[model samples]
Target: MASLLSDIRTKYNLLSKTQKTIADYILDNPDATILLSITELANYCSTSETTVMRFLKKLDYDSYQIFRVNLAKELIDSPSETINEEIAEGDSTSDIKRKVIKHTNTAVSDLEYSINQKDIDQCAEMILNARRVTFFGIGASSAVAIDALHKFGKIGLNVNGFQDSHLMNIHCSHMTSEDVLFVVSHTGESVEVLNAASLAKENGAKIISLTSFSNSSLAKKSDVFLSSSTNDKKYHSEAMASRIVQLVIVDILYLSVFMQNEAKFYKALNQSRIAVSLNKT
Candidate 1:
């Protein structure tokens, strides 16, 4: 929803001259463009409606109305955040800070566009109804797996996390149809994670994956997959950036499950807070 401007910028260099003019018009006048009808926008761009429609088609927008709706939300959410992830060697700490914030904001906005809310809701339903939940990940993704374990366990969901591939394989072999195996992988093609996911599926567990690539094997293997916007090749920053997306998705699913059963979850959550507080003082 909020990825319109980002998509425009990404495809800017590839656009035809006329399309580039349309791109410039939208990029420069997002607010005004949202208010203008398609013909009016075409008029403002000094282009025909066919050219405008063709431009939206390049962006994968099926209808002008939906394009405007998403574009309006994009403008409201992040009107001026230009996504620049490439950090040069001589960049200042301040520059790094700004770049990181901008990248994260843009990544999240891209996620808002790419991710499916229905899939999220379905995942929430699957998780909340599952007899037990298991999380699996490797390397950097292991941290997110453990975080999910901690968050869901605190709220009284039967949850565990396995970072060791061998352990994941062994544990997954025992999963039943009532089980939900939540896998975390940045690439979604991690060999170990996929092997374990396959094992879990063979044993009749519902698999849900959080990954950047929707077409990845892990995503294809799962009952539901949540897409993260860490699709860049910035080796130094990709892992770190994916972590931000991972944490946001985890929090969203966590909140979804909690809100669905607020009274019961609030009681469990309150008990957890009380128990943790006892050791603090």
Candidate 2:
């Protein structure tokens, strides 16, 4: 039922002994296997990164991130998938702790490879120059948009986040050449997001997107696209892993933008903290 394993089953005959060993661990203990880093996996298989890379090359996987993401999706999709996999319920608190860190670190590591420095430079510059900024997303992605709205608003950017699709579509009418619209979508193919983005473009707003794929429609619509990668599809909360990665991107952009006008942002940040402090007590 694991789609990735099924694909590998056909290629089983073609793999060398070392590749077969890696495949065996994946096919036999998929739940445990998915959590391992390339180094950890190699340790489990008694092999080296070279052999792991060669094995992945045989399977046609593009990168370790994509392979792990695809594997996670396939495991979740399997009707027979169990909560107690080979990783074991008996794993000590420390074992679980190490895994939690490694899993998160792996995702962040992928960001370095997927992110484009040039795109960030352009987007940060555009956001700084913009008269107004708006962010839009639906479902889990909406959380990302709202978070961006909060971060930027604190630095004195006139920012808005619309959680409702209808309101976002309606807001497109207000967009202008001097404004920047930041659309956050994990899959980058959401119809509601596309509708809003298209209408905003029609009104002459510059579109900036944070999405998982560079080739996605939202990317095509944007004047600049900032990418994050994930294939995590659990509960149809499609953006779960990508959401964390996107937040990192948001933080990077926030600092980059803030750095461009440090003195102005310093004053705005000070003012925001003071205004919000009134509610704290």
What is the per-residue lDDT of model 1 for residues 1-281, given as tens digits with 9 covering 90 to 100? 43678677544434678998898778657788888899999998899999999999988998999999988887678757533556668889998787777766766666565667998899999999999999989988989999999999999999997777888899999999999999999878899999999999999999999986666799899999887644342435546766887888999999999999999999999999999999995
CA lDDT of every candidate: 0.82, 0.79
Put down candidate 2 lDDT per residue, 107-144, tens digits, no spaces. 55556656678989999988888889999988888888
RMSD of each predicted structure: 6.6, 10.5
The ten-residue window of minimal lDDT in model 2 covers 79-88
> Which ranges in model 1 have alpha carbons more than 4 Å from their true place?
7-79, 83-85, 231-235
What lDDT does candidate 2 reach at residue 253?
A: 89
Candidate 2, pairs of clashing residues: none
lDDT of 1: 0.82
Top candidate by TM-score: 1
